[model samples]
Target: MKTKVNEISIKYQGNFKISQAPKISSSVNAAELLYNTWNKDQIGLQETFKVVLLNNANKVKGIFEVSTGGITGTLVDLRILFAVILKSLSCSVILAHYVK
Candidate 1:
């Protein structure tokens, strides 16, 4: 038998959370910050590309956006991908799986 479960796209209700992480145990390096954020924020096919920012102390400075399929073509600017990372004193980039 081939039964399938139906799915819906209703938005989930939740309040925004704000916290200060001016500095993490780890240095404010892009790679480190990126991995930490991913390990905490995402769930199930969240996105393919991820972006994160960090302060001089390597703490998450701001959000960029993480997704599974944000890329459109092979000619995309690699620099733009790292723009957030470059902008921050230290930042991180993480990759996630996409379910399309």
Candidate 2:
């Protein structure tokens, strides 16, 4: 008899074309993108850690929020973080955190 096992797969889907994705040339550009995408209301209310996934050309692949915590601090599990980066096939990453 054969036993059934769980199957797992990783997938990434982006609505926008990769060519249209904004490229990150400098810290300022990355900051601007992060600021614009961040939730306005929660900007000053809590602490959150986010990862900016980038392609080989330094173009943004997507942003992933790793965790959101209390006003003082947030936790970032390396396993989960690496998992996201790996699954998304990101060549580089810029990490950002919001503090209040």
Top TM-score prediction, candidate number: 2
Q: Pick the candidate with the highest lDDT.
A: 2
Clashes (N, CA, C under 3 Å) per candidate: 8, 0
14-46: candidate 1 lDDT, tens digit per residue: 344325554445334544655555634433334
Please give each candidate's TM-score.
Answer: 0.37, 0.88
Give, for candidate 1, the lowest lDDT window spanning 10 residues. Answer: 9-18
Cα displacement (angstroms), candidate 1, residue 75, comes to 9.7
Model 1 misplaced stretches (Cα beyond 4 Å): 1-19, 26-42, 70-77, 89-100
TM-score of predicted structure 1: 0.37
lDDT of 1 at 23: 47
lDDT against the true structure, each candidate: 0.46, 0.91
